[model samples]
Target: MIRQTGATLTGSREKVLQAAAEMIAEDMGTNLSVRAVAARAGVSTGSLRFHFPTQRELREAVLRRIYGRLVSDDPILDRSVPPRDRLVSCLRQVLAPAGVGAEARRTWTRAYEAFLVPEPTEQVRDAYLAYEREGLRRMEYWLTVLADEGALPRGDHTRAVHFLRTVLNGLSLERAMPADDQILKTETETLFTAVDAVLGPATT
Candidate 1:
């Protein structure tokens, strides 16, 4: 009976996690809630509570799961690609979601309205901070790997990570706004400049 109970618990936990991930991907997690996730998972609230115990725990678990998925397919780990190229590719990947034309504008509009325009509530602020911290952590990891491989000079990469993030943020916004083909041309130039600034101008 105990073994069966354990299996049931594990199954419910997996279902809850998967449901949360799907919600997050679908609507940027705007409607995430224990009740919503429980419904989506086809599990009782008691099961979600049993596995997650707290909302914070559930949120963190979902974020970690999302990042884990990204890490599994991350180009930063592709050693055959030169570090500079890999970094540039990673930056482009970050901007890729902004898309172009109507899709990019819609993404930008939703993001601005959600977290920018009016003052964000405490929960909104916390969610944004969580995502920002995760982004910084990912940037640090990429730079650390390059440094360990002698592709980058060893040093504190905090500023470099922040700089890269800032550049990407600006580029992401730019991608959504109206611009000529020159914006497309300059986007690559901008990425290279940011990468070179961080990695010191790619080895010959």
Candidate 2:
């Protein structure tokens, strides 16, 4: 559902998105300002608005890039692994401890924060809905694949995915903030147990 916003875009439209991505890469600042993105794109703020039509759309582009980097290297996309393992790998991608997956977990937290911030533009509001919808779609798709392969049972996958995602979002926020190892581990266990409850055992 999060198709490339760049696809089928016009000249200035694509340029603006590229510019926004670069600006975000240079600095994913707390402001997430449209004026800054428009400036970097070398377009007038009006032109940027014409192309994106809203701060939310521009923010969506930027948010997309932020998450793109984090999930790009996920083990779920690794074709060599079996389907069941790959599914578990996707779950673990978020629940990862303070080691190899720590950076990604941090990025996930940032992405969620980006989502939480209010947007003045209605276009941005719609874009935020799109973001949430696409996320849910992909999560459900993962569950569908496992169920088709007889690794997971068929049920209300949407609700199940929602439960898992809600838990992950909570974990992301808590992990992103300063917290004791004990608290993080408690939540981490909660996350794992919740996932296991949804999908059953990873081995099965």
Candidate 3:
């Protein structure tokens, strides 16, 4: 009876997590409330609360789930590829979803309107932070993998990850703006430079 009850609780938690992941994928800033997720999962608010307890816990759980799906087949795990090449591919993948030209512009425009133009509510702010934290987590993981393979020196990667992410964010924003063919060339050059700096002589 205890095992059966535990299984039911686990099932309920997975359902709620799936609902939250769907909501996050649909929109980063909205549709993450307990009420909304419970309705989507076809579960009771009380059940979600019993499992997650706080908004932070719910968001973190959903972020991990989403990140797992995003990077489950990541090339970083493919030792056949040169570590530098793998890292470049990883960086480019960050901008792939945003598209280019008009599509990128639209993506950035929507983000500005949602989180920048108006003061974001508490929930919106929390959701945004969750995404940022997840990004950092991913960067750290990539750096660790490289270090494990002796392609990178093992040390605190916090600042290096932050720098890489900042560069990627800038490049992502640049994609939304008007630019010529030179931009693409420069973007690749920029990634190479960042990776070179972070990985030092190892990548060469």
On the 0 to 100 scale, the lDDT of residue 17 in model 1 is 90
The TM-scores of all predictions, comma-separated, are 0.84, 0.57, 0.87
Model 3 residue 20 distance off true place after TM-score fit, in angstroms: 1.9
1-204 in candidate 2: lDDT tens per residue?
A: 433345534666766778766755553433436677667667667667766776666766656655555566766555577665576567656455323245646675555455555454554456556557656766787777777766677877878988878877676656656666586558657755776787675544
lDDT of 3 by residue, 116-200 (tens): 8767778668777888998899889999999999998898999999999999999989998889978888999999889888887
Instruction: Write the residue-wise lDDT of candidate 1 on 47-147 in tens digits.
Output: 89988888767877888778766555788888998899888887777677678767888988877766786567776776677677778888898999899
**lDDT, candidates in the order shown:** 0.81, 0.63, 0.85
The runs of at least 3 residues in candidate 3 whose Cα sits more than 4 Å from the true structure, single-residue gaps closed, are 1-11, 201-204
Clashes in each model (backbone N, CA, C under 3 Å)? 0, 1, 0
Candidate 2 whole-model C-alpha lDDT, 0 to 1: 0.63
Runs with alpha carbons beyond 4 Å of true place in candidate 1: 1-7, 29-31, 67-72, 202-204
Cα TM-score of candidate 2: 0.57
lDDT for 160 (candidate 1): 93
Comparing 1 and 2 by lDDT, which wins? 1
- After TM-score superposition, the amount by which residue 24's alpha carbon in candidate 3 deviates from its true location, in angstroms, is 2.7
Q: Candidate 2: list runs displaced more than 4 Å.
A: 1-14, 22-39, 43-63, 79-85, 95-130, 153-156, 176-178, 182-188
Best by TM-score: 3
